[model samples]
Target: MNETRREYIKRINIVLDFIENNLDTKLSLEYLSKKAHYSAYHFHRVFLTLVNESLNEYVNRKRIERIAAILLVKPNSSLKNLAYKYGFNSDNSFSRAFKKYYGISPTKFKSEGKELLSKIGIEPFSSEKYICSIDNIKQWTKMNAQITIKELPELKLASISNIGNFEKAGSMFQKLMEWGHQKRVLDTSNFKAITIYRDNPNITQTSKVRFSACVTISENINTDGEINQHNLKKGIYSIGHFEIKAEEISKAWKSMSIWVIENGYEFRDGDYFEMYHNDHKTHPEQKFIIDICIPLQKTENIKLGEINNLDLSKYKDNLDYHQLISYMKELRLFFQKEYDTIFKLGKIYQGAPNFSYFSLTTDELKKQKLKFVIILNHKELYFSICLSGQNKSIRKKYWKIFKGSDWNKYHLAESIDNSLSIIDQTILKNPDFNNKRNLTERIEKESLKFINDIKNILE
Candidate 1:
């Protein structure tokens, strides 16, 4: 695509993100045009041409879709409240819009929840999928990319934004690298090429999608012309790593989304982007090794069924250190298996034999890590999750922010002198170590909760 088209995609994408994030608020042509850096008349004409919908129509349709998704999840939720939440002025107006968009009243759509989604061509994913035999999802993701959750650190980036084909990202990356090398800031060891996606392909035309090609930069840099600074906040991300030909990128993303929904995660409103890990030319098949990062949140009010058939009949009260060591290895292996099953791949930390914890990096840029630990002492078992191994100075910088935040849902780590390490509800006490099945279940459930709680604070 041409440079002009790229700029248009970049700007319109910013507007698209603004609209999605502020769905409950009133949006005006004047404000949106300002955001796009275009005259109101020109912005209106361009938006209609590129998006194939007038500003009002596009916003209203998105609002209606949001309501439909929510109504299906919360059937008893007040319709008037839901309408008002999505910017409807009155019940009559919301009802009219709902019918026009979905060909049914809000009340009727709620009653026929999954049916409503089918009629509107919306993919249906409910809490039931979370409980269904994991066979389908396991098969779906098995041959595809593996998915894992990690905490990303805040990044200082030098970026060039453009609208158009994603293939144009190469030019942007090249520009940043050239500039960085001239300024003596492009260190090969730590260099990273990333793309910040601004629009949803499902919602916006592919030709009009906006992307910001960015490279990690040293702290505080000056820029001129179209080069801009974007600070990416630290948070938890569901990362899908793929090594595939360019044509298969869309399938990789679809697999990532499917994994999230099937596993009962709600899409968090944030940037969706890709991080390129290797040069495509190096691969024999010319496949790109990229990590597709999507922000995610575990669904609220989800009730999981108990594994009643779990057998915990075997009990051994006493064992030699050799036997104890064998059990610890089994424990580590169990967690590794579970983590691999859910996250695709992760770095497991078994630093100490008595207490081995899996460490997930909070931010690769800052070298920070979150630790999930399992401790066993004969008849007793304990699980602890916390943040640790962060640079002390960096922890000092974020200490006030952590201190000012809520800690009701998490346990502050007891051993770490620095305040960065956090424990999850403290060590679980007296878990049935003899019952491996039940113990694994608790570890699986609690570990996820730990990850989620820490994400809330970091994000």
Candidate 2:
């Protein structure tokens, strides 16, 4: 992790600790400010900047979350008592806050006993959720599978209007199309389209499903004023082609929503029209091929982490571990020459005591003209160097670290191997460290042994 991200995580942990300790107390701005070691006036703003929520909003939201969880497990619990237990003075005030945040009365929530945890936006406590596994990225990418871009123009169409219940709108569109076909008014070549909802599903009602069953028509083939012309604004759209079975449309929608969030694009609150390219009518099995389009815009402060798309099989036998290590050392030296801040040179060994690993402080690391560290484990290597400061120069220096090499081709494992070798070499040659050579030799021998162990396991 870089310095900025590390500090941000540390601050969040401190804030969480304060919240946990003072959950039952009236947590005021002054108290939290002192706990977070910031001025009272600045604390609120800083907290919101880092966490995307105001202090009072976060505290109240968390309290409501706890209350919802309690209600689920203890359905017969008194609403009034629960409110007081979470630091609310009056039942009326608690109910108002709960309803505002969760869109349900506390009494009704307790009686209904539905899983209100997700409804209230409270995250479940699970270690799996915080594991930050690489598999998550793989699964997400596979489901979203890269889509092709297509530009479509203005379309004209006709449809039935529904008040609410957007999910039903799909069936309504199907009925309208069938009706049109029966009347011999709908042209199969006109292109089927459905103008579905653009509102919050959580708050929207079943009676108010806003939708339009429409189609694209040629200008020359005019219909008597009954059809509406939808000027389909032209822009870049990622179009995914998928055949949705009758029972799996909801799953498709959920996957699309996750893709949008992961890619840092806000869903345009407009009609997310889907084109039914083919349906069961043409092929007896009724496999419906849908073209799903989501509008996207780039926003500041949103960045996706590096995606691993390496094809490891291609380079399984051709990789040069030694050359890669030297290249990484050269890159580290280049960064040291270009940046002014502290750089930490560190080595971490596999299967070694934790105390054996040594890290340079941000101050000491930056003072060195050129420093590197490497850790050797039985079958793996680890390498890390710090480029200090939050300046543009520092960013530019680090950005060049991965340039001009086949670094992009190697997987995460290879990169770590190269990094560890450089760090180990640097620490071994350090004249100030009395036993540098012995330590380095031991690391190298242990790393080879670790590799043998891994090979044996694999075999």
Candidate 3:
């Protein structure tokens, strides 16, 4: 029987995944059709209608893609053995199928197929030349990333699919948020944006890759639109946490893959996805804190390590009010030192021991008494570029420009908007004064960036 659009997509994906993983085994029409819960006669027609490829053609293409990737990485392996290993009946048949798909003999592909293989999206970086890039691997490891393997629970997601470029997923996410709001289930505690990657970039052409922008939902909710319900299978996953700019995402993925390979983990044939922790728009550097999860083969011999032991001990929650005041003193001193070094202005405005205020006076706006404020509290610690003083009218005049300008670019304070503004970046969640110098550098860099952004906006 033919399935609904959602069912067809879901069942076909299961079959596709099975096909990719079991290319070395027999995958007869009856078997695949039964697995997809369809009668063989209707299954063939349904598969062709949805995937636009005959069952045999689609299976052969994926097998060829997989073989191409393996050959690129293992150029020294026997061609005949490789062909047989991937379920080819004979050398002649394999050669014909390979040639038909790639327009080149396997021998020619191994000898001079780098460009051709890349054109078909089968560029395996495990090739001898790339494997020797020890420096790149070292740099990646130095990111101090702590990767762990864990059993992930199956997630039922409300997802919107996007074909081709993954950049289009942003719009999908926005639409999902709008949908969640309309349904009155948009609480932040449970709601989270996720991206499901459906194709291996190493084997599939990027422009033909499929993905879905999804949000975790408690159960299958009613949806009559393009947004459909999907389930992420529960399995062992190697998750890598990353804090990086958007452009560094591809590098992060590569690094994670390398880490997995180095740590002796085999990748499972299933969906890979990313779950975001913070909004990039709110980050001062526009960096995303994302957890990249890769499904792994579940074997008895594999011993998994700690799953979520990210060394964030430098930020602790037991800070009392006295400790807060002490940490604020350190922050104030550091800010004063930085300002004095740059502008020769020493300890300009030290507000009660809990906060510090520094003045910024350019020739054009000296009367404005623009101050950069740093606040340390038991609950949270943050700093921002704001306006303070008795200059009420001047503050109001500039506040108008600040509000009307690209204020979103600045991290505006959420609670206090009148005299204080733009607390876009938090210096520390829980301060530890023992590592004061390092924390000082981080806050100083962020404070300067905030000042510069505000200056441009005001100008």
Candidate 4:
């Protein structure tokens, strides 16, 4: 992924977000470059190429625009305090910069902010012309949405970027679904169809606004053509669930922005997206059921660097992915040579880099359309064996039977859509590989236990 165009875009987006949220804090190239996990030299080149502006110039412009925006809403705010807050040494310097950018003194702009901003064709975030009235807007929002402040988890998405036209989302989603099915990475059980606004609609020109038609995927995927893979970072968000017609979606957005302002919640620089729950054409009223997500400032309780403390890699084995695959092949051969006539064996399968497995089935189990799999998870450093089926339909059928009964001998997979396993048991956790023979013996013994137990149930 390194040096790719999409990788640069993803890194730059992170830096852009950090600048937006931390305008009042010291934003040095050294710190920001580290945040993007790039050298300062490469970071500068990429940022310039992608943003079409030097990093310092962009940061300065953002700071000035933020001050001007605040003055639009609060004319009497102390210029000195605001100047110092946004990284100016003195009021004189702030006033000079403001005049240079807006072509008027800050004091004059404060009095005629709306008119001045309109002349430049940049509407204030909360323009009265955009909405009827605060009360009416509130009523409309209350009728159309159920709003909540939630902390959302990180999402893995396979997305198609669509610039300017959001109407082509239907076709984009269709393409994504087809691609997802082809790759066998669709979540199926808890999948989400999301549209992420890459640029602020309020700030960017309508014809230039960017959106990504995205869907939840089960695993990491390589970027292909126009489709890219990205992780929507976990963060706090203001979520508004709405069921509205196509034409009224713009109104829903306006109302949601007003709700954030009225509730005294500051907007953060994360993505603003809509998660669609149902197809509008299916509804009698043709209303789309969706959840609009607006990123918000993390509360004081969410301490910085909290997530960094919890690293799962410590629990994983030091064995390389290739080394683990080699071991799995050895185990597969061990089973084939030992079981011989008892259970037919399959070759080792390495679907993704993180995991690999092989199947074993007896004549009786094959009649029931079932197979057993011994899997090794390189990422988690665990070995497990599972009872699976020839296909999804067989897996689902038996899954339902076990789910209804009290067969608690093993852990059952929650869904069969993306999973081949119906029932599973971890044979070894944090395996001790220093004694290779001992490890092999333990696996063989536990594997026999699972195979025999499952055979008794269905044989």
Error of 1 at 3 (Å): 11
TM per prediction: 0.50, 0.34, 0.56, 0.49
* lDDT by residue (tens digit), candidate 2, 247-309: 545444445545655555554423466667664466323656676666544355334322112
- Runs in model 4 deviating more than 4 A are 1-57, 66-93, 100-111, 125-130, 149-151, 158-179, 207-213, 220-236, 263-270, 280-286, 295-459
> Model 4 reaches what TM-score against the true structure?
0.49
Q: Give a tens-digit lDDT track for model 1, residues 1-459.
A: 577766776677668767967988988899899999999999998888766779989888878867775665457889999898888889999999988877889889888756665444443542232324345544544444545566678877888876667777777788889988888665466678889876654433456556789888886676445566677778767877666788767666666766776666677767788999878887534778788888765445322321111122222454333455565566667766656543322333321222334444434323443333444433234555555434444544454455566755665444335343544454456665578778677766776677666666666
On lDDT, the leading prediction is 4
* lDDT per residue as tens, model 3, 1-459: 243776777677667657756888999999999998999999999889877789999888878877776665467879888888888999999999999988899889887666775666565553333434756664554443446788888877887765476777778798888887777654456767899876666666777566779897765676434666777888988887776778767666767777777766777767789989888887534778788888899887565665332333333565443455566666666655656544323232321223444444444444455554555432234544453333445456555655666657545444333444433445455444677788777777766776677666667
Instruction: Please give the distance, in angstroms, between residue 429's alpha carbon in candidate 4 and its true position after superposition.
Output: 61
- The lDDT for every candidate, in the order shown, is 0.64, 0.47, 0.66, 0.78
Ordered by TM-score, highest first, the candidates read: 3, 1, 4, 2
Tell me the tens digit of each residue's lDDT in model 4 across 1-459.
344876777677667757867889998889999988999999999888877778887777778877875675467888889889999888888889888877888889888766776667665555566466788887777656667677888999998775577779899899999999999998888799999986665544466566789999989987675677868889988777776789778788888888877877777767899999888887535778888888888766433322211123544455555567788887888878888989899767653445679999888888988999999876678899999987778999999999999879899898888786899999999887677778889999999999899888874
Instruction: Please provide the root mean square deviation of candidate 3 (C-alpha atoms, Å).
Output: 11.6
lDDT for predicted candidate 3 compared with the true structure: 0.66
Deviation from truth (RMSD, Å), model 2: 25.4
lDDT value for candidate 1?
0.64
lDDT (C-alpha) at residue 221 in model 1? 72
Residue 214, candidate 4: alpha-carbon lDDT: 92
